[model samples]
Target chain A: MKSLLKKELSFYLNNPLGYIVIILFAVFANFMFVKDIFVVGSASMRPFFDILPWLLMIFIPALTMRMISEEKRTNTMEVLLSLPVSETQIVVSKFIAVWILTLIGFVLTLGLPISMYVLTGQVGGRIYLPEVFVGYLGELLLAASFIAISLFYSSLTKNQILAFLASVITIFFLIIFSTDFVAGVLPPVLQSVLNYLSPIVQLSNFVKGVIDIRSIFYFLSFTALFLFLTVVDLERRN
Target chain B: MITVKNVTKQFGKTQAVNDVSFTAQKGEIIGFLGPNGAGKTTTMRLILGLIRPTQGEVLVNRLDPLAHRMETLQHIGYLPENNPLYGEMKVREYLSFVAEIKGVSNEEDVSTVIGQVDISEKAQAKIEELSRGYRQRVGLAAALLGNPHILILDEPTSGLDPIEQEKIKNLIKKTAKNKIIIFSTHILSEVEDIATRLVIVSRGTVVYDGDKPKRKGGVEKLFKKLVV
Candidate 1:
């Protein structure tokens, strides 16, 4: 499992296109924060957390677009399955790789929040430590969910483009299901269920700087469900 | 040694392999011969524990392939059909990764197989940069890592030139002296040249299983009769 993880990390770190995409994600992250700073006329993490779900819908899929799909396309999935590695090991290694890449990109945006506190300390701008911590917690949970979702889609098809598009569209629907317009289209009871299913709604709880056990379960269950689906789907092809 | 006892696999309603039973002892090159889609690869996948046998059992080295998957996997080396490789990785780099995945991390195994496959010169080249023949060699080199007890090569030379075909056949001959090799090939001449035994399957059933031909073109005659 460690070897697989190392191999995956090497693929991302060494590939020119892979590293370039990661760098580009960071650049856009900082850019998002800077633009938000101007628009809001204040230094807070609300905008960053707000745009994260959208960023993740695109970025996580790009990170995992080839996870299982490429192996199937190249027929290397057979070779991998024939090895001594377990299915859990392979899936976990890939999930960890995507998580590592996402976290690195998320970390790059740290400079903005820190510099906001530092540069604007003269103007009474304060960085709420607890909110920043919870926001980061939300980021990790959302990333976990998105990465798992992408891996599941990747396992379903050999085409990376199809995997990317499918996961993006699924996540887009999940995000919008929490909105007022979409909620209005459903019955009151169904709307509540949709809001509970929405990652954005769960993320909103974290950005508000509160730790809700229900939200934690929601993120974890969402991640676990998809990861399990990925393993089972790949197993069927075997 | 591998024992496949009345193994049958079905994908939905279609029986990919039906009641297939065979034993591959150590040092035997058992060639699985059939036309395309004739369950050769399916049986190989069964032996490798890639899929479950719906109606029977497959044992690798006395252990069930599924129950003792990782252990059995350690004992067998598989070169899947099409020989998929990480196109971005250098030959040596890819071999090293295989070595790690197979629990053979030492540089010695990597270098030894690189030399054995005659890819020492191309070790630094990316897999996509190599010729078809060389890419096949790299695939063979990876299979050779850790000196596994059993080898499963699924159509190892299907798309190669005559020269490349000869090279793989010779490589198999050299390596099969002590290790068990179960390879699938439609080319009867290649089978006659390399395999010690023949197991011919047609439409998911093994019609013939016996020793290497005692006479010239004998396996061909037998294969033709059984395949159709």
Candidate 2:
């Protein structure tokens, strides 16, 4: 299991994809955060927190789209499955590799928050550290769920582009479920049910410094469910 | 010993393998010969438990391969058809990774297998940069790690020059003692040179399984007569 994880990490670190994703993430995320800081005039990270899901929707899929698809495309999945490894191990290793890479991208963007802190200190504005920490945790959980979903899609097909598109479409629905457009179209009871399932609603609680255990459980369980599905799909190899 | 009994693999509407049965004991090299889409690779996959048999069973050392996958895999080393590899990784790095998976992470084992396959010179090069012959060598070297009891190679010499083919044949010959080696190939001369036993499949069914014919004209005449 360790060897498989190491090999997955090597593919990420050695190839240009890992660095490219991180670099684009840092640049685009910071750019949007900075743009919102001057307009909001309170050094708040609300805009950053709001834009994070969209950023991850694109980037996480890009990172995970090739995780299983490339192995199938090149027929290396045969070699991988023939090893003394189980389908669960392969799925977990791929999940951990993408999670770690997302964590690295998070670390690089720490400078954005630190800069906000220093600017707020000099200008006599208020910024809550607790809320920022909670918001970052929320984003990490969201990214984990996205990674799992993207990996499931990747395992379904041998084409990376198809995987990427499927993941993006799925995440788009998850994000929009809590919006007014979706709410207006649904009956009130169904709206409440969809709201509970919407990632946006769950993520909003974290961004507000609520620290609700239900949201955390929701994210974790969603991640686990998709990973389990990926393992089952891979085991159904023809 | 490797035993494939009445194995059939059906993919959707297509039957890739049909009621095939064969057994090879230790110290025997079985050359699996068949034309394109003849189910050679599918049979090998069944033995490796990459795909389950539709209506039959595959056993490695008297245990069901699907039920005892890790144990059977530990005893078997397979070089799949087309020799798929991580093209971006260095040969040595790739082998080391495979060694770690095989529970033989010792550097000495990796180095020894590299030497055995005569690919020591290209060990530092990326797999994509090596020629077809060297890539096949790296695959063979990976299979040789952990000193597996059964070696299943699918078309190990499908596309190589005469000299490279001879080298691979020699490597198989040198490693054939006390191990069940089953390799598939289109080259009749390869079976004539190294195979002690022969199994030929046509259209997903085994048509012949017996001792390699020692008479003049060798496997060529027999294959022509039996395959079609």
Candidate 3:
């Protein structure tokens, strides 16, 4: 498992795509932070959290789009499956590699809050460090779940484009089902059920500094479910 | 030694391998010859535990492949059809990764296999930059890295030049002296040169399984007689 993780990490580091994802994600997130947090003069990072899920919806897919798909396309999955490693270990190792990469992107965005704190301290307002940290945690969990989903979809096909599209559609639905749009359309009982199913809704609780156990379980369960599916998919493809 | 007992695999309605049973002893080189889509690759995949058999069981070294999995795979090295590799990785890095996964802790053996397969010169080159023949050599080197007791190579010499082909053939012949080697090929003459036994499958069933012909009759003649 360690070897597999090391190989995946090395592959990502050597490829230009990994660097491109980091640079592009940093630029886009910072741009949004400046436009919404600085230009609009908001104390709460609601806008920042608002845009995070969308950014991750696109970015995580790009990161995981070729995880297993390209292996199949190149026929390297056969080589991998034939090795002295179980399917579960292979799936988990690749997931951890992509999750760490996503976490790195989140860590880089910490500069945003630091910049805001400095700017605000120069003036007269409070920094609200705890709220922003909580928000960052929420965003990280959401990104991890989406990455797992993307990795699972990537295993289903040899085409990266198809994986990307499938992930986007799935994440979009997860986001939409959590929004007021679905609540407004559904009856009282159905709305309650749909709201519970919304990953974005679960994330909103974290951004509000609540740290709900239900939300945490939802994110962890979401990730586990997709990872399981990825393992099963790889086994079938083999 | 590898033993396959009444193994059958089906992808929905299309049966890829049907009730295939064979035993390959250690130190024997067997050839799997068949037309396209005739279950050759499917049988190899089943043996490697890449896919599950729909019926019956496949045992490698006295343990069912599906039950033991990694343990059974540790003693086998396989090169799938088309020489699949990580195109983004350098030749040496990819081989090293395979070696690590295959539990080859001996650094010298890794280098020796790379040199033996003639890929040591291109070790630093990325797979995307290498030609078809070079990629095939890298794939072969990876399969040989573990010094596995069983070698399952699918079309191992498909895209090589004459010189490289001869070198690979000779390597296989030398290596098979103490290991079980099963490779699928369409080239009849190549099989004649390397295989000790032949198993021909037609439409998901083994149509021919016997000793290598002592006479000059080609695999095509046998294939026509069985498949046609």
Report the number of the highest-DockQ candidate.
Answer: 2
The digit string of per-residue lDDT tens for model 2 on B80-151 reads 988999999999999999999889979999999999999999999999999999999999999999999999
Ranking by lDDT: 2, 1, 3
Question: Residue by residue across A73-144, what tens digits does model 2's lDDT show?
Answer: 999998988888889999999999999999898888888778878878887875788998999899999999
The fnat scores of all predictions, in order, read: 0.76, 0.78, 0.91
Which of the predicted structures, 1 or 3, would earn the higher DockQ when compared with the native?
3
lDDT of 2 at B155: 92
Q: Under CAPRI classification, how is model 1 graded? A: medium
What's model 1's lDDT at A134? 95
The numbered model that scores best in TM-score is 2
Candidate 2 — which pairs collide?
A: none
Give the poorly placed runs of model 2, Cα more than 4 Å off: A123-126
Candidate 3 docking DockQ: 0.70
Comparing only chain A of model 2 with the true chain A, what is the TM-score?
0.96
Against the true structure, candidate 1 has what lDDT?
0.89
